[model samples]
Target: MKQITKAVIPAAGLGTRFLPAIKACPKEMLPIVDKPTIQYIIEDSGIKDILIISGHNKRSIEDHFDRNPELELNLEEHGKADLLEQVKAIADINIHYIRQKEPKGLGHAILCAKSFVGDEPFAVLLGDDVVYNDENPCLKQLIDVYNTYGGSVLGCQTVPQEKVSSYGIVASEATAAERIFKVNDMVEKPAVDEAPSRLAVLGRYVITPEIFSILERTEPGRGGEIQLTDALKVLAKQQNMYAYDFIGRRYDVGDKQGYLEATVEYALRREDLKDNFLEYLKKVVK
Candidate 1:
């Protein structure tokens, strides 16, 4: 197997959930605390070469990572070296952008990156889902599984039975290794009663190149959009695919409640804001 050096981030969604706020700013650019949500995805991928699948009104995502000489000069003039370094570091990341051209769906957005990914196994991190892990990044954990197993690996976490309809739930049997499962089947956002299991597939994935061909012939499903889940199901039948119960707290930042929870938790984790934020939280609850 080849080393997973490339990553694809499907950020082309219009973010209808965010509505008025997202009308001007891309939801992927929404800040969790001080950093944009998409930045977390890029950093967690632990790779330099990344392709960002973007769409209309998503120019801010590109600008955020591109060099800003004026801003750098301003920070220098103000003697804010630390802030300058932080801004410069973001531009240093090797990011490539491609327009989805249409709001087809996740599968279409991913298919757009096929040229960039070439023949190598690549990681896909969704902009809406942010996984927080102090020790290992979620994408890295999936890549580790791909390295060991030589097949597609999904980073999954068990969600509540009631929430199974919100994700691509997988039916799988446990493997000999801890926190690993051999995926038998996948259902895209099945009704709670119809769901196979509570093991919902999150945004992180390490997929082999064979998926592109599978996606090519995949007809649009569920809302008349080409669903990645639909393609993955076909791939699962052709070869062994595994799901790793990744260690992390995943926040579906696309949802209003999940965004607030992520913001509060991320704020509480910061040393500069923890004490004051915790006190304020306590006061509010009381």
Candidate 2:
């Protein structure tokens, strides 16, 4: 397998859901706990070179990765050197930012990174989907399958039948543990009767560069925007595509309810807030 050294994170959406909060801040910069949602995706991917595709209103998202000398000094003065080191490490990762001139769609945002990705296979991570894994990193698991299979890999997870229409469903034969599958076909937001399989694409993918050509030729679909799934469908016809039932709990921060759930769940896991937060939750529920 070729060394997968680059990752593309598409954060160009207008984030109209969180209006006022997102008016000045990018949704990807929204805090899950102490860390921004995008940071979690970046850390989880473990890739050093990241191309962050942003929009006109999302410059703060890029600045977050840059050095903040004053913030570091404040942390050090408070005897929080550990926290200071964490802030310093943000600059250690190579982050490249490019603007999506228009609010086209996910496909357009990804197309903006074509130059940065060049001819190499790259990983695409949707900033809204936060995957939690206690063992292996979700992206690494997909990369492993890509190495063995030498094709595109989409990270998938089983969802209830009723929720199939909200995702890109995959039909595949189980080839290993619940974590892997040999995909036969992909259907975007298929109805229950038309659904391929329960394995839903969960916003993580390792795709070959061949996808660029397919995406370029793809016309606007639903919402009058180019759909990435459509491009993947075309690519699947010409090359092998596998879906790995990645072992992780994914939180869709794109929705209001899911965003709140992720914030509460992640906050409860933090040592700084766990004890008091759990106690407060118990009292409230009682």
Writing each residue's lDDT as its tens digit, candidate 1 over 154-238 gives 8899999999999999999999999999999999999989999999999989998999998899899999999999999999999
Task: Please give the lDDT score for candidate 1.
Answer: 0.93
Q: Could you estimate the TM-score for every candidate?
A: 0.98, 0.95
Clashing pairs in 2: none
What are the per-model numbers of colliding residue pairs? 0, 0
- Report RMSD (Å) for each prediction in the order shown: 0.8, 1.5
- What lDDT would candidate 2 get against the real structure? 0.89
Residues 1-286, model 2: lDDT tens digits: 6779999999988788888889888899999988899999999999999999988778787778999989998998899988889999987889999988887778878888899998999999998899988688999999998988888999998999999999999888877655677777788889988898888999999999998988899899867888888888888889888888888778999889989889999988788899999999999999
List ranges where model 2 is wrong by over 4 Å: 176-178
Evaluated with TM-score, which candidate comes out highest?
Answer: 1
